[model samples]
Structures are given as C-alpha cells and as structure tokens.
Target chain A: MDEIKEIMLDILEEMTGEPMVKEDLDLNLLEEGLLDSLDYVTLQLEIEDRFGVLLPPSEYTKEELDTPRRIIDVIADKMAV
Target chain B: MSVRFYDGFEFFVLAAILSAPAIWLGVTERRIRGYGIFASIVVILFVLKDSPKSILLLAAYLAYELLLVRLLLYLRSRGKAGKGIGRLVIALALLPLILSKLAEQLNIGGFAILGLSYMTFKSVQVIIEIGDGIISDVDTADYVYFNLFFPTILCGPIDRSRRFSADADSVMPKSEYLQLLGDAMTRFMTGVLYKFVFANLLALAGTDRPYIYGVYMFFDFAGYSLMAIGLGNIWGIKTPDNFNKPWLSVDMRDFWNRWHITLSTWLRDFVFSRLLRSCMRAKLLGGDRVYQACMCLMANMLVMGVWHGLSANYIAYGLYHGVLLALTELYQKKSGFYKRHKNETAYKAVSWFITMNLVMLGFEIFAGHII
Candidate 1:
C-alpha cells in the first residue's frame, strides 16, 4: 500500500511537473487544473502500465478519480480484485 | 392540433391533472412505478395524437430499438458478443436518427419524429453499455418508460437506463419523496422565471448581438431542462442536471463542464474517451499525445455539430469550438508562461474574459450570424 501511494504520487508529480506533498493528496486535481482531460488519459494509461489495472473510463467517472488519494485507493481496490 | 410538451400553461396544467394519481401515490409512500408508466403512456399518446405520422414513426422506432437491444442481450448471454457485431448493432441503433437528420437537411418531411434525437441518445447509451457488459439485462417496460417519460420526451437531461430504472423500481419513503417534491417545486418555479420571464424578455428586447443571443440560449435551454428535471423528480426519477454555473467558466473546457452538461458528458464518455483509448492503444500519431488529443476533440465536436444538423452553420459552430478547445489544450500543455502564471487571480480573470468572447463567437456561428 505504501509503495502504491509513493508510485501514484510520483506519477502525479511527473504529470503536473510540480512536487506533491502528502497534504496535496486530498486536493481536487481536476478542479485545481492540475489535470485536464488529456492528462487524465495519460494517467489512466500510466496506471495500467505500472499497476496492470484497467479503469474503464465509462465505468469510473472523473469524480471517482479526482484526487490523488482517490486515484490511489481506486488503483488499490482494482489491484486487490 | 399537436400538443407539445411544456409548450404553454395549458400543457402544464393538463400534465398536472393527469399526474395527480401518480403524485398521490408518491406522497403516500406507495410504489408509483406502475402509475408512472401508465401516466407516461397516456401523456405520450395525448401529445402525439394529432400527428398520426409522428405516432406511427415513434412506435416503429421504439420497437426497432427494443428488438436490437434484446438481440444484443441474447448475444451477450450466449457469449457470442464480439467487437464486429457490437459495432454493427450500434450503427443499426443509430440508423433512424441518422436518416432523420439527413432528411431534415435535405428539407424532406415525415422522416423526423418528436424527440427522436433525445430518444436515440438513451437507446444508444443502453446498447453501448450492454456491449461493454456493464448492462446485461434490460426490462422492456423500464426501457419504454425511460425513452418516453413525457417530461423529458421533447428535450432531455438524458437519463441513463440503469439510473432511471433504479429510481423507477424503488418506492421512496414519504419523507424522502416530500423532500424531492420540495426541490422539484423550486426547480420548476425557477424554470418558469427563466423561460417565461427572462427568456421572453430577452427575445422581445432583441438578440441581435452575439453575446445577448448566447445568454438568451442559456436561459431558454436551461429553463426547459430545469422544468424537466423538476417534473422527473416528482415522478421519482432523479434526472441529472443540464447546467451548472456556466457563465463563470474560465475556459472552453470548463464551459463544457458547466453548460449543457449531460450532452457534453455523454459525448465525452461515449465518443471522446473511446476515440482516445483506441488511438492511445494503437500509439497513433507516433504517440504525439497533444496532436492525438486535438484530433479527438475535433472529431468529437464535429459529431456534436452534425448531431445538431448537417447544415454548414452548425458544422462551422462545432469546428470553431473544437479549434478553441484544442488551442486551449495546446497552450496549457505547452506554454511556459501559462505554467508560471496560471494560478494567479489576474490571469484567471483575463482567461475568463477571453473564453467568454470565444464562446459568444461560437454561438454566433451556431445562430448563422458569423458564418
């Protein structure tokens, strides 16, 4: 779980080109403009590459994956399944 | 003497009278699904009775879509569902809407039916989801009710089959139903003000200017959407909202999220996302993400434009917004200045002003003023 969190944060920081802190986990990535639709597509592709989990865009809404923490949790859940 | 949904005060009064029993059932905490379905049938028939051609077309369209859905379900159940067949089925589902749009473009009559565009959205969504295996079963009555729910039969907040069925199948507790009713009443009244008062005033005052016309469009469409949502609530269907604080949007992308929300989201999920997924998987454009994004955005918006009509003006409007959105994407992704000052209040205000003008320009193109 800790490894997954670290990896997720790294991916987000790489995408946004800014260092992310633990406190930023709860921030709304979309609402804050840290991510756009294109970035979101990239993130999903990266997740599948790294975590081997598929998050169908139709099944999972943007709201469901809005925050870094939420993305991590969803990835974890999918991995568990 | 064809009666249109929500056309006048007389329509609302008649609808209210016809819905009395369903409303009573809802208030008493009884299952209103049966009565709701019954009311929907009566309302649809009454609204289309004078237009025999429309009635026949609607009935035929419904049967055709239902058969396609059932066939798809059967294929899925038998584990014979494949990509080739799925695509064909979806095209078949969209045939009527495509022909209707084409016929309208050629100035041919009798091919179009009331609410055909909105109904196609619902039917196509169901068919796609079923192909995705997310939706395995579809109840016939629930399907008909979702398509012909009289409140949204003309325009729509485009309720999904799964969400609609969930609400339609459940009996809300009295307290919950009351709260929904309260909210519904508020939305309905607000819609009345927006449509009957503000929209009419704007129309009378003049929509000669692009910005004024854009605002008029917002109030008029949003007003209709609100009333439909409110009425849906009374019937226990939590129809999604069509507009947010759209005028406050700071960019073209943000505007889409805040305006005509259902249609935009529908396109995003069904069209844009799928296009991107396929392209990315194939590593199209040699994995040039920005170019791929721009291409998808253009195609998505073109579909939107063509959906409105095959006219040059509508196509130009769609293309205009598509270019604006693509340019916005390119700038945000590639510009160093934007990266540095994007978070500043001054920058955001300037962005908002620019985006507003661009949106108004697009609306002008849509209204055939600039094209």
Candidate 2:
C-alpha cells in the first residue's frame, strides 16, 4: 500500500508538473485541475504500465478515480484481485 | 401527420392528463413505475398513431434491438462471448440507425423513425456494458421502459440503463417525491418560457445572424431537455441534465462538458476513451501522446458530426470543433505561460471570450452559414 501510494503520487506529480504532498492525497485531482481529460487517460496508462492493472475509463467513472488516494486504492484493489 | 413530441400546447395538456395518475402515485409515495410505463405507452401510441410508417419502424427497431441484447446476454452467460462476436453485435445493433441515416441522406422515404438516434445510444450502451460484464441481467419490461420513456423518447438527456433501473425499481418517499415534484414543476415552467417564449422570440428576431442562431439553438434544445427532465422527475426517474452554463465556457473542452452534456459524455465514454485506450495500447503515432490525443479527438468529433447528419455542413461543424479542441488541448499542455498564470482571473476571462467566439463560429458552420 505504501509503495502504491508513493508511485501514484509520483505519476500525478509528473503529469501536473508539481510536487505532490501527502496532504494532496485526498484532494480532487479533477476539481483541482491536476488532470484534464487527456491527462486522466495518460494517468491510467501509466498506472497500467507500472502496476499491470487496467482500469477501463468506461467501467469506472471520473468520481471513482478522482482523488489520489482513491486512485491508489482502486489500483491496489485491482492488483490484489 | 407526424406529431412532434413536446411541440404544441395540446401535447402538454395530453401529457399532463396522462401523467396525472403517475404523479399522484409519486406524491402518495406509491410505486409509479408500472403507471409510468403505461403512461409512456399511451403517449407513444398517440404521438405515432397518425404515422403508421413511423409506428412500424419504431416497433421493428425495438424488437430488433431487444432480441439482439437478449442474445448477447445469453452468450455472455454461457461464457462464449468472443471479442469478435461482441464487436459484430454492436455493429449489427447500429445497423438500423446507420441505415436510417443513409436513407435520409439518399432522400429515400420510410426509414425516418423518430428518436432513433437516442434509442440507438441507449441500446449500444447496454450492449457494450453487457459485453464488458458490467450488466449481468436485463429485465424485459425495464429494458422497454428505459428505451421508450416518453419524456425522453424523442430527444434525451440520455439516462443510463442501470441508473434508470435503480430509480424505477425503488420507491421514493413522500417527502422526497414532493420535493422532486416542486423542482419538476419549476423546470417544466422554465422550459416553457425557454422554448415557447425565448426561443420563438429569437427565431422571430432572425436566426440569419450566427450569434442569434447559436443562442436560439441553446434555448430551443435546452428547453426541450428541461421539459423532458421535469417529466422524468414526475415519473420518479431522475433524468440526467443536458446542459449547464455553456456560454460561459472557458475552452472548447469545457464547452463540451457544459453543452448537451449527456451526448458529449456518451461519446467520451464509448467512443473517445475506448479509442484512446486502444491507440495507446497499440502505441499508435509511435507512442506520441499529443498526436494520439489529437487523432482521437478528431475521430470522436467526426463521429459526433456524422451522427448529426451526413451533410457537408455538419461534417465541417464537427471537424471545426475537433480542430479547436485539439488546439485547446495542445495549448493547455504545452504553453509555459498558460501553466504559469492559468488560474488568474484575467487569463480565464480572455480564454472565455475566445472560446465563446469559437463556439459561435462552430454554430455558424452547423447552421450551414460558412460551410
């Protein structure tokens, strides 16, 4: 879980071009403009590459993957399965 | 003698009379789904009675799609749903709509079914979801009701099957139903004002001007959408909203998120997202993310435009927005200045101004002004 969190933060920081802190985990990535439509897809792609878990955008909504914590949790859950 | 949905005062009067029982059930906290379905059938029959051709077409279309969906579900249950078969079924489901569009383009008569496009969207969504194993079972009555819900039969805010079923299957509390009724009344009245008063006035004021036409389009379509939503609420279905403050959008992408929201989101989900995922998986454009994104946007917008109609003007309108969105995507991602000061008020104001003009220009192309 810790490793997943670290890697998710790193991916987000690279996409947003800003350093992400632990406090930013609960922040809404979409509302905060950290991710737009394309960036969201890219984030999923990066997660797929790193974690080997594919999250189809259609299956999961924007809200389901909105926050950094939620993203990490979803990825981790899929990985566990 | 084809009667348009939500068109005349008589239609609303008839709708009110037909919906009275369902509304009563809703207010009394009774299950309204059965009555709602009955009312929808009543309205659909009345609307299509004058046109035998349309009634036949609609019936045939419904039967075809329902059977197709059932077959797909059966296949999925047996664990024999191959990707090739799934894709073929989707294409087959789209065949009627594609043929209808082609017939219209060819000036052939007898294939013009009202609400075909919206119905196709609902059917395709179900098929895709079932293929993905998201939806396990589909009740026949619920499927029919979801597809033919009269309020949204002609035009739509395009409610999802799962969401619609959840609302339909559950009973709303009296207090909650009453609150929804009040909101529904407000939305319906506002729709009346928008469609009958404002849109009519705009039309009378001359839609020859591009900006006038654009605003007119909003009032007219949004008015229809509001009334549909209001009616859906009365029937205990929380129909999705179709518009927000689109005129104030800060970019092309933002505009899409605001305008005809359901359709844009539908395309985004089923078309754009899927397309992008496949492209990225294939490492298309040699793994160039920007180019891949641009290509997907263009293809997505073209599908949208062609969905409108196979006309030169409509194609141009779609491509125009595609270009604008691609450009917006590029600017936002690549511009250093944009990154530095994007959150500032002045920058957003300028962006809003630019986006509005570009939107109006697209509307002009849609209206066949510049094509």
Best by TM-score: 2
User: How far in Å is the alpha carbon of B296 misplaced in model 1?
Assistant: 0.7
The estimated TM-scores of all candidates read 0.94, 0.95
- Please give the range of 10 consecutive residues that has the lowest summed lDDT in model 1 chain A: A16-25
In CAPRI terms, model 2 is classed as medium
**Candidate 1: misplaced stretches above 4 Å?**
A1-10, A17-25, A50-53, A73-81
- Real interface contacts reproduced by model 1, as a fraction: 0.43
- Give chain A TM for each model in order: 0.91, 0.90
| Candidate 2: Cα lDDT at B23 | 78
- For B1-371, candidate 1 gives per-residue lDDT tens digits of 54568786668877789767778989888887878878888878888787778789889999999999999999999989899999999999999999998899889986777799999999999999999877888989989988988888888988778888999999999999999999999999899889888998899878887688999999999999999999889898899999999999998988999999999988988898888878988999999889899889989998999899899999998888788878887887789999899889999999999989888888889998976
Candidate 1 lDDT at B216 equals 94
Question: How would you encode candidate 2's per-residue C-alpha lDDT over B1-371 as one tens digit per residue?
Answer: 44458887668888889878887888787898888888888888888888788888888899999999999999988989999999999999999989988998999996788789899999999999998778889999899999999999988989889989999989989999999999999999999899999999999999999899999999999999999999889888999899998988998899999999999988998898888888888999898888888889999999999999998999998898888888888887778998898889999999999999998988999999887
